[model samples]
Target: MAAVTAMLEELRDMVPLTAEGAAGRFAVQEWTPEGKSRDGVETSWHKDGIRGWIQKFRSGAVRVSFAVWIRDVDESGCFDALDAVYEQGEQALATFLPGIEHSPLTGHLAEAELTATDKDEFIAAREWTLDERVLTAGVVQQDTDLPVMVVVALEEPAPASA
Candidate 1:
């Protein structure tokens, strides 16, 4: 069951992640297929502790994700959370904040874009990015996988050839 509550305020219109096999690449964002690297090693990962990964898919898109513990890693709850957040983009993302007296964190940024200003009223531990489309990704989890980690990302295509 997706927590009986709504997702973070920062996210809602988030496009939930589709199901994937264990070995499947959970890629929703675009990436550089060749010339960059064939391995899925995202050296540009800014955030630590469950960092965001950049993949190679010829899209040059980057992925940023945040994790929302489904109270207790429930599959239905994970999908439910994804659905709720998917329905409300920024609003759901905003819901992600430092946990207070709440038992077990319901939401926390597993990924995000950097801030233009050195200081943001939101989560401060995260790195900032000039890209406005960073947090605008979707809420998705590997199908049949642990529901503890919910993924989000943004895509930026490479510049046109000269």
Candidate 2:
């Protein structure tokens, strides 16, 4: 969850979409892309396991998808807005690749499409498979029966014990 949150924050900063604040332009979510208005964009991500035994040892790739919908009062305005958003989104994601590689993600942009279009709105989407190595799930336990040791020291040894 931390990784996802951080990634989303980074994305929100990189892109023009709005995830927080009053003048929000788009909605962002993890694992689900529903419940958002048709006039705004939505981002959803999921983990897809790669075929290999070693995948169990490391973090698997995460497929982050963006669903963009633009709306306007007029058909022409809507089409223009959709085109602008789509182009900006494409460029923003491309510019974000270098940062992704330096962060927890390793892969590049994989796919993109304008999945739907209508008179007053359009839907554009893009996907990137990130090679994240951090574990987002599971837990580890340590044996409580193991021996324990504690050491306490004071600065200057408490003035040499006065």
| Among all candidates shown, the one with the greatest TM-score | 1
- Model 1 C-alpha lDDT per residue in residues 67-104, reported as the tens digit of each score: 43222244565667755543453343445432311313
Model-by-model lDDT, in order? 0.33, 0.27
Error of 2 at 141 (Å): 43
The residue pairs that clash in candidate 2, if any, are none
Over 4 Å off, model 1: 1-48, 64-92, 97-134, 146-148
What is the clash count for each candidate, in the order shown?
A: 35, 0
38, model 1: CA deviation in Å? 4.8
- After best superposition, candidate 2 residue 58: deviation in angstroms? 26
RMSD of each: 14.4, 23.2
